[model samples]
Target: MKFNRTAKAHWKGGGKDGKGSLTTESGVLKESHYAFKTRFEDAVGTNPEELIGAAHAGCFTMQLSFFLVEEGFTAESLDTQARVYFEDGSIPKIELELKGKVPGMDESKFKELATKAKENCPVSKLLNADITLKTTFES
Candidate 1:
């Protein structure tokens, strides 16, 4: 199977002073505002790193759900957070933290499956940085 997704960005002026808007084909991010402050400083807007973190978290969680189903278990809840570590103008690593509640799943099994998901998720595979997973399972 194959799928294609498109996102557009528009920027004006210099790198440090320029402002931009991001739009995805799905309209989920219709003209979302972003700028140098948003990326480097604590500005109240979206940035590429934030977007990448969201995408990685979403992909890994969904992949873990599939693995859980295959293992004859269903998660009551799964919360994942992805932290992109950026340094020297590059992303050095991404950390995926997952907390999940699955009625009949063991901690070891949950960790195993989450690790597999972190390795196999499309976004995880796409990134050229070190990826790590930390899992917390609740009964």
Candidate 2:
């Protein structure tokens, strides 16, 4: 099966003073700007890089949750933080941090599942950067 999603952005002016807006084919509109900080800062929209990180983190967490359930374990909560670092002359690096509370699951197993999720997630497959995963488990 094949599918596609569309998002559009419009920018004006130079990097520091330029501003932009993004709209998904699904109709969600956001504002962005360099002055706002990120590629699309608080000028009113979302940036592509930030959105990518969010999607990757969310997808990995959901996949991990499903894997846990399949292993006969359930989590009380799972929180993921994805940091995308863009340096002066190199590809961006994505660092994923996950913290969760799973009852009756050993830390070793949890780590295994988290690692699998990071490795197998669709977004992870699309990126060409250094991906790192750090997970913390709690009973």
Candidate 3:
């Protein structure tokens, strides 16, 4: 199976005075500028980086949930947060933290599943950021 996603940006003027608009092939539109703080930061909308983090966290959580269920563990809930750090002259880093309540999964097993999800998620493969994952399981 194959799928494609597209997002485009249009910018005007120089760096500090420049402004832009971002639109997804899916039809989501956003306004952006340096003063707004990101690709889309003003009354316009969220930035690409923020959207990336959101996607990563949501995808990772769903993958982990499925893996846990396949292993005969049922989770009450799973919450994941991702932090993406970008440096001008350096590679970006993404840190993922997840907390969950699994009825029958021990910490060791939970950690294993979490690691697997982090490594195997599609977003993980797409990211150039250094990815780090930390998970906590509650019984």
Please give the RMSD to the true structure for each candidate, in Å.
0.6, 2.7, 3.0
Tell me the spans in candidate 3 whose CA falls farther than 4 Å from its real position: 25-36, 39-45
Which of candidates 1 and 3 is the stronger one according to TM-score?
Answer: 1
lDDT of 2 at 93: 95
Clashing pairs in 1: none
Write model 1 residue lDDT over 4-100, tens digit each, in one string. 9999999999999999999999999999999999999999899999999999999999999999999999999999999999899999999999999
20-128 in candidate 2: lDDT tens per residue?
6766787645443323455534444456677878989999999999999999998999999999886784546999999999999889999999999999888898899
Q: Over the stretch 69-107, how does candidate 3's per-residue lDDT look in tens digits?
A: 899988898999999775784448999999999887789
What TM-scores do the predictions have?
0.98, 0.82, 0.79
RMSD of 1: 0.6
Off by over 4 Å in 1: none
Residue 103's lDDT in candidate 3? 85
Name the lDDT of candidate 3: 0.80
Candidate 3 lDDT trough over 10 residues, lowest sum: 32-41
Off by over 4 Å in 2: 31-37, 40-45
